[model samples]
Every structure is written in structure tokens, then in C-alpha cells.
Target: LAAGCRTERATSVCLLRVFSVCVCHPEEKKSVPSDEPFRVVFRNFQRTLARPVLLGQGEAGAARGTLQVSRHQDHPEVCVYVDASSTLPFVPPKTCAFLGPLFPPLFSPIASFLPSESHGVVLILDGIIQCTERDEFAYQEMISFLPLCCHPNPQRVLIVGGGDDGVAREVAKHPAVLEVHQVEIDERVVELSKQYLPFMACGFESPKLKLTIGDGFEYMKQHEGAFDVIITDSSDPIGPAESLFRESYFELVKRALKPNGIICSQGGSFWLDAGHVRETLDYCRKHFPRVTYGLAAVPSYPTGQIGFFIASLNPETEFREPARQFEDAEIDQLGLRYYTTDVHRAAFTLPRFAAKALNP
Candidate 1:
């Protein structure tokens, strides 16, 4: 038996053979074996020796383990999990191709055209918008129309944090929404979404839509008691979005709405981020007269559960069922793949734990 090793990249694999070493050249060398069964191993791009096996190999190629990898469109440095199958398409665990770094981080905007783990591909018209997690349209629809539908007659609406134009598209659907003003902090998110994600931003070109590039909190403070419905379509409480989740922001939202106005804001997920949801709910209860927790199942989001906090200045709000009637009609007409009348009702159904946290 002859022992020889081959190095590829930074790792080397050993191929066992009986009576080998027929040719040995540094640049071009071929291992020759004299009539004997041998083993060959391919160099793995990533180290999988210690990584947890989601699935592992079994007897007789029993199809137990799998690995798959794809480049994330938004952030390329990050690798994404494409699929894991025992047969072909062996995907590496926890590797996503993130396309975000391909362009300049400050101004480069990327829109996901193919629906991945996050939002459906939509074009960003003005500012930089990126879907970190969750289905973009599911959350966008609720943020746009929830407060719009809650009010008896919503004429002027303001949306904060949805620069990707998905919320703007939904807000333009209602005839009663005479004017929809969207203030986004980043202009690249909107411009990128418009170029790449057209379907997700369906009606953003409407005449009633007004795009403003500014800080949403400062913008709201300047326009007190101006909007009939104020929708905060912000991201999770991290990075630049931390301020949006605070009591100060909620107070601004309250001040920006009319006397009997309704404000619905994205409050994170009730399933996984319960503590954050509870904190936001409690903040709303203190600031607004009517505070209700609603849920929406967005497949793109983790845990498949999303939530919204509806706060009304007037406790006597007439929460009307959607005039379009989501129950009996085909959900496609509503431009939704997740939200339904059942979901709408169930989202408001709080478990004892969450209810106690909010009410207490």
C-alpha cells in the first residue's frame, strides 16, 4: 500500500490505493493503483466536521444527509440555504449568498425578484429598502390598509418606514385615501425596489402617492394632528429602527393623528419575539385609548406568525369589516397570499400569557 495526499484550496483529501505512485510531478501528477479497491474524497468548500448535522448519512447510501448552497441576492457575502436532499443537490448547512455587499452598503439598493425567505421581489422606487426577514407583501398590506380600513373615512394617510413602495401600492388601492404620504429615511431602498421588485410594488405610481425623504419621527413631530390614519411600517427594533419601537415614537404617532384617528404599526411577531411585542403593546395602551394586538401569518417570516398593534385616539372607533369581504371572495383579489378573514380574527386572539402581559 502506498500513501499519498492531494491538497486543493486550503484542505487536502487522502485517496487510498494499493501499489500506487506510478507518476509523481508537482504541477501535473496522476495517482496510479495496481488493481485494488481504493477510496477517494472530495475537498469540501466549507468545514462541516463540527457543524450540527440537520440530517446525516445512513446505511447503503440510504439518503440520510444533504447539503445545498446559494448566493443571497441582497447580501452576497452571506450564503443562503437552497435545499438539502440525500441524493443530488447536496446543500451546505447555514450558507446563504447575500448580494448586499456587491453594491456599496450606503447607497446600493437591491430588490428580491424571486420570493425567497423574505419579501416577494419588489422594486424600490426612491430609498434603500431591504427585507431582512418575513414576507414583504403580507406585512405591507396590513400596514397600509389596517388603519385605512379601521377609520370611518380616511382621507389623508402617512406611512413611516416603507420606502420599498409595497405599502404605498396598498394605500393607493382605497378610493377614500385621497392622499398617501410616505416618508422614508433611506432613498436607496425605494429606488432599488422600484428597479427590481415590480410586482410587490403594484400601485406605487398612483397620483395620490407623495414620496418624501426624511426622518419619519421628525416628520411626524412637524405635522401634528394632520393625518387621518398613521401607519408605521418600520422594521424590527435594531440599528436605525430602534427609535421607532420606543414610547416617544408612539407618542409622535398619536400626536400626528386626528382626534378620532386610527394608527396601526408593525409590532413584531407574537410567537418568537413575544417580549418585544408585549412591550410595544403596553406602550400603545398607555398612549392610545384603544390598543389591540392583531396577528398575520407571513410565510417568509420565521415562526410563520406576524403581529400589528392598532392604537386609536378615540376608544369609540367603528372597526368595520373590510368592505371588499376577504372571507367569501378569492384571496387573490385582495392581493394577499396569507391574510384572510380567519387570520384577521385569529390575530387579535391573544393567548393568556400575551393578554396578561399586555393588560397587566
Candidate 2:
């Protein structure tokens, strides 16, 4: 068989031939024999091998496996092939596409065990890596504690879209936090995390938690001026999470926050997409008087880093110095692996390039 062929910003649909998968514009077609296996290659996407399967043959087809093809408006077509007979409960996709706009094509959540030294498990939603056990604390602690520490009295806290419960687990560690409210749209993510990743799912068991399986937007609307700190632990701006990045969502979040309320969201990576990070921060600034960006290092996330957009209703709120400081013993007691009083201040100190792009 011939080696794989590459395409340069080809058309939308990818054709599956017998021996070789052809990726080309709609008007351009190629003929190949039907015997050997082949691979499909796109310029900006990963290469994947395509296996032959009968289109429709009743039980025979069912036994063969399932093929899923989807595309975002700004992305190339993504094809995921799942083997029906695999022993693993959830299989990771071979490749993931670039981040797309909100409400883009949807992909099922997949959890897979890593064979690395850490023996960590990773959560992937919509073909993007959500978190990995080895470095999840970096994100969870930063997103949860950044705003909590910034607020003088974070008595009541609301978590949006943290179905895995990592954020809830971190938020519960705050001493002043009395009530914890969380709303996750998909219960399956919670269920899967509970069964596969109990370390994170244990957040659901916090005595102060009130878990609600519903839309966060509506949940916030019903509870106006309720929370002192609101953390949006959502996935990338795609699928159901698209709205969370818009100005309208910030307006709703602002309405739901009590006076002097603070919010921290999972902002996109400045290294990967500085423009997108700036755009999201700009939307947040529309409703917030004080807004700043903070960074964290997570090995599994895209670009090996992620950021948070922290904002406050009070104009005098300081993102650099934490209003609440934790001693070494207190940090240890809180089980904080990534966040500290010094780290909290350092997170806001961006590199020259990033500061110019995100702040300037």
C-alpha cells in the first residue's frame, strides 16, 4: 500500500475509501484499491488511521463498531472510530481538533488511564483535555482559591460547570465559606468521575454542598445577589459552554453575585490564543469594575498552561495581594498543592509579552 497523503486546508467532508481515506475538496475525488489499510492526514490536525467497516448490516454492523464524524464551523472534519468490543470502558480519541466557537459540534466525554509514571487518569470532553490527575490541583486550586482569597468574606460560593467536582472540593476548603452551591448540566460527567475518579468526585460529598443538575444560567437567575464568590469551572468555549464566555453571561453572573462579589473563570491560554484570551477578558470587563488575568501550569492542558479571568464588583479589589493570607500550616491543612499566599500574588504577574497582549 502507498504511504499516507497530506492535505492543505482541504474542504469540509473527508471521504473514506476502501484502502485509503481521501481528504480533499468536494469537487476533487480520487480512486484507490480496496485491500490495504491507510491513514488520513490534515495540515493542522493529527493523523489517524481509518479501518474498513460495512455501512449497514444489522448485527454484523453492530459488532463491527461505531463511526462518528463531526465538524465545527472553524475546524476541519473530525472522525472518531470506536471499537465496540474494546474492554476499556471509555476510549480516548486518536486526535482532537482546535478550539471552536460556542455551541459547536459536540463530542462525548472520555476518561482514560495513563500509563505514565504518575499513573494518572485524564478527563477529555468534546475532544479537549479537561484535566489530568497528575496536575489537576494546579487548575482546581487556582480557579477555586483565587477569587475566594481575594474576597474578605467568602461566605457563600457558587460553582458553575464543575461536574467533576474538583472546584467544589477546593472551594470547600475555605474556612469562611459556609454554603457551597454547584450546578452541572450533565450528570453523566459527575457519575463517571465518581466511579472512575473518586479523588475529585468526593467534592460532591461535602456537607456544605447543594448540588443541582441544571443549567447554570437559569440557576444564577433564580438566586440573585446570593453568592460572595462565583467560580465558572467550565470547559473550553464550545458546545454548552460557549455562552459562558460572552458578555451576556458576565451580566448574569454579575447579577447573581452579592456586593463586593468576586468571580474566577477558566480563561483560555494566552500562549495558545492571546487574542481569544483578550477577547474573553474584554467581555468580562464590561460588567466588572476590577478585572485581571492569572496563570497556572498544568502539564496536560494545551500549551502546558491555562489562565483564569478574575473580576470583582468593587473597583478597589486587588488581584495581586490576597485579602486573606494562609500560613504554611494552614496551607498544608487545606491540602493545597498549587496555591499559596505568595503564589496567589505571583499568578497575576504575567510575562512581558502576555501582559502587553492581555493587559494592554
Candidate 3:
């Protein structure tokens, strides 16, 4: 509260346009310790902010301090705000990848917690982007449709963690799907996605989708042999997502699925970390009889790519022949851009290097 003031809501930028020169350093939840000075958004308010300025930052409750300009001893008076506890931290005017930019990385948006009232995309660095309209269909459609199409008729599908992304909506596109049950650990993701990311958030609004805000593992444990297809729309394999990859979790998923159920999960990128792909596939192979790998290219995701680990309970389940094939007319009716019947067949064809490394 040095010179900048806070209103009833959080303010990442100085309200005074004249004092707009600012320093933005956001500290993601656990990646950087909260005690670091960079954890707060440092805003300097001044009519003429021409010189370099450095101000000592203590705790949030510390008394307001003055900005010590390095060049001029009699520098213009300035006010600043060090808000480490802001509900929605600001990271300057970042590139809204959805809007496209000259250099995408430089203008990339900050993925942090969005304000309760906000309705646009929020870039949560720790959790990553919450599905953008530009490329969400690539990942969600591939992950959801690849498994659903493999099954003859997926009447009951289980979604592990696709709370807001339009995963359930894509699953519902198949007319045979009677119900889609989703278990998300966090409900805020659903609420935030509904308001901000309306394009992908339609998954929550689908009548076939049944959302449960609870532990996906426990939910599966209680409902055994119930689902025809299980889709795990998880984030990176860290923290909460770490558990989903464990051998025990697969046991729960096995129990939850029908006799010939199909399962698909977000496998890590092939280019960034191939070791994770090999290891996670090993976990899937141990539990299921037939298992294979597929990938989708999404510009927003890390390495401009993401992959899927698909496994089927029945050894006879043919990955190639979809139970219900979609004609060109049907594909158009579904409004699908990335996923076509041919794409489904091609996704499983591993690259030469991948074939040698993963299959060999």
C-alpha cells in the first residue's frame, strides 16, 4: 500500500494510468517458495518513471516504504503495492495465445487462479492452461473419441478429471452414449471453465454428463464394473495427478470398468519426456491385456504435442475397427475439426523412432 491502492476486488495493475510503470514477477504456488520477493506483483506509481528504482520488500503487513531512485537523489515521489496474497495475481499484459501473437511465448498468458467473477481463460503455471478455444478440441476430442469409438457402444463412460474442458461433450456426441459420469477433485475448475472458457466448458452443461466433485479413485472403488469406457482427463503427472498413474489406481479403474471396457489417459509429451511415456505405458500393460500409444498435436501444450495411453480390458478388442464409424456427413454434424475416422486409425501408427523405442 505504498502509493498504489487496493479496491474491493484485487488489482494487479495500478489504477492510476499515469503511474503505470510496473514490475511483474509471479510466483507459482509450489514451484517457488511463497517467501520469495518475486511472489508479489510490484507496481510503481509515478508521473515520470524514467530511472531504475529498487525498494526493499518486507512482509505484506510491513509499513509502506519509499522508492530509492538510483540516478536522482531528489526523485519524483512514487507509491507502490506488494500484493503477494492477491486472489488473481497479475503478470503484465501477456500474449493471449487464443488471440495469437508475434511471439507466442513472450505474450503467453499467466495461468493462475481466476477471480470468482472472471469469464476468460486463466493460465495457471503450476497446473498449466485450462483449455483454450483454439486447440482444446485437438486434445479433448482425441482423448475422448479414440476410446469411445473403439468400443462398440459406450453407453456409460467414466471421466476421471476433465472437469471443465469439453471432454464430456465430445463423449456425448456418440448417440449411443447414455450417461457420462465425471469425478473431479476440484469443482472450481468446472465453475471457472463454465464462465471463462465457454467453448470447451460445454462439457459440464451436457445432459449426459454427471459431475461428482470428489476423489476419482474412491469413486471408482465404490462403483465396480459399471463403466463401458473410462477416460482420464488429468493434468501433468505431478501432485494430485501423480496418484492416477500408480499401479493401485489402475486396479481401481479395472474394477470400475465393464468386462470389455476401454480406457484412455493423458500420457506425457513424447518429445519432452519419452521416459515418462515408456514408464506409464508399462503401468498400463501390467493391468490391461491390449495397450497402445497415440498422440495429438496441440500448439498450446508443452512441446506443441500431447499423447494418450489407451488400453482395453479384452484382449480381442481391435484398436483399428471402431464400433460405430462416422461418415463424412456425421463428422460435419458433430462439428469435429481434428478428429476424423481416419485420424482415429492413424493416431496409433507410431513414428519410426517411437516404434523402436516404445514397441521394441
lDDT per residue as tens, model 3, 128-221: 3435455677888899889999998899999998877578889988788999899987776676566556777777778887889888988998
Better of 1 and 3 by lDDT: 3
Task: Name the TM-score of candidate 2.
Answer: 0.73
lDDT score for residue 86 of model 1 = 28
Off by over 4 Å in 3: 1-122
Q: Each model's TM-score?
A: 0.65, 0.73, 0.68
Model 2 agreement with the true structure over 1-360: per-residue lDDT tens digits: 111222344322223333233232333333222232343233333222111112111111123333332222243332323333334232333322222222212234333322222324544443344566678889899999999999999999999988889999999999999999999887766776787678899998999999999889999999999999999997777556778888999999999999999999998777656777899889988888899999888766645678899999999998898999999999999889899999999999999989998874
Candidate 3 overall Cα lDDT vs. reference?
A: 0.64
By TM-score rank, best first, the candidates go 2, 3, 1
Predicted model with the maximum TM-score: 2
* Strongest candidate by lDDT: 2
lDDT of 1 by residue, 1-360 (tens): 111222332221222212222322334333232232343333332211111111111110113232211212232222212122323443333322332332443332322222232222312211122342235667777766667767778899998978767778888876688999989887766666666566655556889988898889789889998999988887656546778888988888888988888888877665444667778878888888777877666543434556788888887764435433444455566566555655555566777887777666
Worst 10 residues of 2 by lDDT: 50-59
